[model samples]
Target: MERNPWSLGWIVLMCLFVTNRARELKVEQVGPDNEAVYNHTLATTLVEYASAVYISDMTELFSWTCSRCDGLTEGFEIIELIFDVEHCLQAYVGVATNLNAIVIAFRGTQEHSIQNWIQDLYWKQLDINYPGMPDAMVHHGFYSAYHNTTIRPCVLNGIKRAQEIYGDLNIMVTGHSMGGAMASFCGLDLTVNHEAKSVQVVTFGQPRIGNTVFASYYSQLVPNTIRVTNDHDIVPHLPPYYTLFPQKTYHHFPREVWLHNVGLGSLIYPIEKICDGSGEDPSCSRSVTGNSIADHLIYYGVKLGGETWGSCKIVMDQRLAKFGSKDLGGNFVFSKNPASLLQAGSETGSISI
Candidate 1:
């Protein structure tokens, strides 16, 4: 039987159409509706608390005695120091008496110096739905980091404890790098499970957490989130988003505040940009290739992964552990040496994969 050329072409065209629809990218972009206004002081302040979470000794962290937290955590009383020895994850749950808010700060990747969590954006699998968004699939590593270990339960217990002590005070969640990803999960968890009233999340050098569905879901559920990415900070651009491969791609939530420097010559101006609410704004940090690890370490002149050579040192004064309460309040302060990314800048690992 002779086959008509026109009939053959029609079959091929139909195959292409079916394949395209099968892999129809589940991404949706809405006009920029940025409601989360960037706060300079608050951003600067939260990064300090985020940095302080890198402390090894529980006593130092619980006492609010870390230098990074000095002057900033003055009114904050630590309620719980969450650490999962197995997963190597650490976080702190505390109450800021002065601010009348509860704080949750998660520790990022622990490296002595020159921390590089986003050398490459690679993922083999992606299957996880956040609290309220079933269609939204998130990054596997981030999902495992936040959900697969005891860290989640510990954090929950800490939040529950804080609420019991402080009443339904506003919750503030902050972290840097990988910790920021975990903070995103915690914020959503609090909203869905704990029935948290007001949740504010601020993160530094945070990477993309989920796909478009997850991003949109997160933006709607946790509306007051500020993701701060510094100039050339490579972490936020990963796990890379591929327009053609939406199912395996990772995406960020809305309201990214990018910090970069604009200069003509001797005089320079530092600029902090509020990205479009669409979550992937080309005019924002995405404008650059995102290839700097040094930018990931410091946000507003503060080193995020500080002195982790001996991080989360389990030092216990048994007496204090047993008799310890706010009733026996005291602080043992330690000094910190921070590298500035603006005025006198320091550089770290600078390779992009």
Candidate 2:
């Protein structure tokens, strides 16, 4: 076969361009302990759930948790959207139609009770607030694969799918933990591509992705995305969540993560130097309490179902399954009670930011 040199060169350049543009890890840093400003800063990470919590808000965003509604087919409504860009994995998706907007939900890790497996992996090898924590976590085999890589494609595919359905409608991307990260990436892409007039992101217990530069770029590129995190959710404090594409990073862990493990220590432990300092910085010290991961894990139970840890996991799993199921809008049928999920917050689901 004869090959043209010019064409080959062009192909190679295109390949390089696409590869570079694709979601890959980059690192950067921002300012010091500035929680007020830091709450809004953007960051990314591979191991931690940092990416999950980063999100933006919108004017039309609304929520109406309902056991039943008239327009909705089901008594409860939890819509998710999944896409397979290259037909990689048969992605699952569901969309809930609210008053005037749409809630873009993303799926996450499956349910498991393998603390021992996690412990055997050597808790010390992983980053934890205390030395024995990694060990303890491993003993419980409570590990998660909700990393940056797992979610990037899911989000990319969703953006394309959402634009296709409600191209002109406003979007509010939301998720908890890993799902939150996917939502963040998806919302950012929507803004960049001009798919919607506005994009609002609301997440809980999300970790970081990319790095400081990525966060800055993300914030500059899409200012409307607002990330909401609990005072301290452990899952949101993983190490990879702390460093990415290089930018200033923030850690949201409760004091217990620190108090419980003297040897383990937290990734943000260093911030105490400034956050805990006297005068105006005391607030920074207080902000560093709690564990984002724990908060994330427990949030499902508090917001979705159950009152116990195991029940929380079950509720979260069911909710994620709700999002991951391909049959919701396709094969599945809904009842009126579930219709409330569609009508909950915000009527138009449109934000022009």
Shift of residue 282 alpha carbon in model 2, Å: 8.5
Candidate 2, residues 8-91, lDDT tens digits: the string is 666655664464344222121122432112221122111112221111111111112222112231221223323221211111
Cα lDDT, model 1, residue 85: 58
TM-score of each: 0.77, 0.42
lDDT of each: 0.71, 0.34
- Candidate 1 wrong stretches, greater than 4 Å: 1-34, 111-116, 123-125, 246-248, 309-313, 318-353
Tens-digit lDDT track of model 1 for 1-353: 99887676667656654643453221111234535656666777788889888876555566566676687667567766665655567787778766667888988876433343444355434566665577888877778887887667767777777777668877889998889999998998888777787888889988887888888888888888889999998888887878787655787888888888764334355677778888889899989988888788888898888564444334534333432332121312221111201121243322210
Q: Which candidate number maximizes TM-score?
A: 1
| Model 2 regions lying over 4 Å from their true place | 1-99, 111-167, 240-286, 290-293, 304-353
Task: Give the number of the best model, judged by lDDT.
Answer: 1
Model 2 lDDT, residue 130, Cα: 16
Root-mean-square deviation of every model: 15.9, 20.3
